[model samples]
Target: MPSVLKTQPWNVHRLPAAEGKRFLVTGGNAGIGYFVAEQLAGTGATVVLGSRDAAKAEAAIASIRSRVPGAKVQHLRLDLADLASLKTSVDALGPDRLDAVVYNAGVALDHPPRRETKDGHELMFATNHLGHFALTGWLAPLLVATPGSRIITTGSFAAKSERLDFDDLQNTHDYRPKRTYGRSKLAQMLFSFELDRRLRAAGSTTLSVVVHPGGALDSLTPSRPQVRVRTTGERLRGLPLGLLVQGKEAGAWPAVRAVLDPDVRGGHLWGPRVFGLRGRPGLAPIWDHLADTTTAARLWAASCDLTGVAPTFTPV
Candidate 1:
């Protein structure tokens, strides 16, 4: 099992402005991604909001500009559901080296039947995992340009409930939206760990870290009858089982910690300290089986094959 470390919970008051850093935050228009961009920008980091909607991206930039008068914020068009859009956004990033890329964008299927994204992949799986997978792969060159560049991805506690179904990646055999979403997140967690291993083995300095917001109520949560019932019951009973089920700002802390903490080691998972629910930021534990070498390798191969982007690192 990966060792869990206890550390002080991080708060925004002590966060330093990223004066010299450049960051790209996916889904920065609203929810957790917005707060993360705001915090990073407050620290003087040049933040680029990556959104599927150009207008929404521009509006998000304006909102940030209002708060942080001199905030350096820009918008880059990116649609996770469209591979062509992903490629265009990456190519349009110009030649600037990126300090960090936070994969905060995700979706949950509210209905029972499975839906497909523009890329012909399961909606939840494509938006939550593969989309980010392709984006990160395309942006690897820019990430490599900077020393200590980090790729921070958002996972979820739900990942514990669903394991990757390698045979049914797209849910062709059995399409359960909830299960699919969980599987996608599991893939994300595994990818983060595997990427770190591969980077180190290839002698690369870039870091890949995964984090879960716990069970925060954000836009990603489904409002379907079943979802509402389950969530409502948890709230009514005051169940503390959900990981970090709190406000958007609190939920974004793990990603923020992963992005800014100079001492954070590669491959570490961070989240809320209180019952895996809402709280100040702390080092969150990862299940040992989540780091299985065999599983990681298989997922890595599958992601590459599915996305058509070869791993940049030559495995040793």
Candidate 2:
């Protein structure tokens, strides 16, 4: 690790200007994704909220405009679960070059009988991993055409201890909601690293970086009435938890930094500085499981087979 990466002071409030650049954030209507979009919009870049619901996206856009005053933001109908609609959704992304796409959207089932998407895949796996896998493939042309474009994957700390069961990738046999969700996220992170390797091998300038929000809590998040309304009591109760966890806004820092920081490189994992839980965004060490190239390659093949989309990179 470079000493600069360790010592550089990154002021989350003072973001670099990104005028004329365009970014797409999946599930940008809520949680950390919403904050990611809001922060990027503050950079004077056009921000598109890729979501499945129009009403939620509109509310998020309105909230951003209210805060940033003239923030260029819009909604793009994107349903990650619906792999069939991904190509059409990319088409709707317009003909303009995309500077970055943040894979932040995810579905975590709290209590489940193990749901499946219309595509006949596990719901969590479909939405969190396969969806972005396919979307990246569809967006390859636009991304490859744009100089120095980025694909940022928002992984999870929950995935730290989990490992992908290649035999039961979809959790068809035994599905524990939380464990399965962690595996799905682990799969996504591995894909990002594998994608970076592929991009480098293809001699592409497009970078694929992975980041994870330490621990984000709605109670700790600031109130954005149009999107999220955190009650006074909730804030008071969450104050104690702030010692270890953080608000969604702070949680957005890693991904935001991954997008705007010129120093960020492909195949690196960035996260919170304090115990990988809360604090300023910084370069975090990649987990041992994440470095297993064999596992990543297997996941890539499985993803391509499942989503029917294989991304190919070329130098810009």
Specify the highest-TM-score model's number: 2
lDDT value for candidate 2? 0.94
List runs of model 1 lying over 4 Å from the truth: 1-9, 218-244, 314-316
Cα displacement (angstroms), candidate 1, residue 130, comes to 1.1
Q: Indicate the residue-level lDDT of 174 in model 2.
A: 73
Which pairs clash in model 1? 17-43, 18-43, 214-243, 215-243, 215-245, 243-276, 244-276, 244-277, 244-278
The model with the greatest lDDT is 2
- Once fitted onto the true fold, the runs of candidate 2 whose alpha carbons sit more than 4 angstroms away are 1-7
The true-versus-predicted C-alpha distance at residue 226 of model 2, in Å, is: 0.5
Model 2, span 1-316: residue lDDT tens: 5314544578999999999999999999999999999999999999999999999999999999999988999899999999999999999988998999999999999997999999999999999999999999999999999999999999997898999998899999978999999999999999999999999999999999999999999999999999989999999999999999999999999999999999899998999989999999999988889999999999999999999999998765
Per-model TM values vs. the true structure: 0.88, 0.98
Residue 140 error, candidate 1, Å: 1.1
Model 1, span 160-191: residue lDDT tens: 87777777777887677788788888988898
